[model samples]
Target: MSVSPTSQGQAAIFIPTPNYLFSASVNLGTPLAPIPLLEGGQRIVEPITGGTIGGPGFQATIEGGLAAPIVLNSGDGTKTQLAFIYAYGHAQDGSPFYLEESGIGGGPAQTTRIIMNVGGKFQALQKMYILAQPKVNEAKTLASVECYSVPTPV
Candidate 1:
């Protein structure tokens, strides 16, 4: 008789915890009307007016951006959201950064992937994988996203 170990199929470079990066509070403008697409898909485009972002050693103002989401029925009396967002911001010390994100979810716990190109002290984020949890208020006027840096094994 022999015993064999089973695997959960996770990658070898998987890191359980991620480092805290920053949190962004975004103010939104009124969204444009939803345009109907084929196969019951609806496209909604919104504008990001302004906001703020702060973290351990960085603070910045969110200048502007766009949010375009395509929604489709899930056939279970629910809908699914696929969001694509972009933001351009600058820090207090004149450092500029750009952020792009994509997520799929209709609930508050959205698992988002973030990519940021920043200068100044936060330049280390250039090679790191970023993940975020974003939450938007019911009024759709404000959004708060908590970002983290994922460290992988070499």
Candidate 2:
């Protein structure tokens, strides 16, 4: 059998604009001892003791048990890069949420700045929606969150 290249259907691509969900400042407690990785990377787990979330109609404190494990990759020797983290929190009404963020950040260890894409899921209630049908039924929003990190006083 022989194969041939042929023009096919048009590709449909949609770029979603990230709706501003909220701005949160996370407080990462003192990091635990770094666990050496096999690939010359180090895994560090920081405790997310507390924080705050603010948006259009929601505000809440970030719950504990949220551990952010950042894997630092030794890159060009000038600076170490790459970090990945997963965190969880709750809204003022006790509704829960989780966030996953990954990006490259490098500088001094204590003042390193991380720019990462944060995304998470949350349940929506009647108050959060105008339509009655969606408000009453099981509703949720998968949000693309924008987040930045700053060293907080412990």
- TM-score per model over all chains: 0.86, 0.52
Q: Residue by residue across 85-135, what tens digits does model 2's lDDT show?
A: 455667666666555544455642222222222223334422131110001
lDDT by residue for model 1 over 22-81, one digit each (tens)?
899999999999989977889999999999999973589999999887888877878878
What residue pairs are clashing in model 1?
none
Clashing pairs in 2: none
* RMSD of each predicted structure: 5.2, 14.6
Q: Which lDDT value does model 1 have at 101?
A: 93
Candidate 1 regions exceeding 4 Å error are 1-13
Q: lDDT of model 2 at residue 33?
A: 87
Candidate No. with top TM-score: 1
Return the number of clashes found in candidate 1. Answer: 0
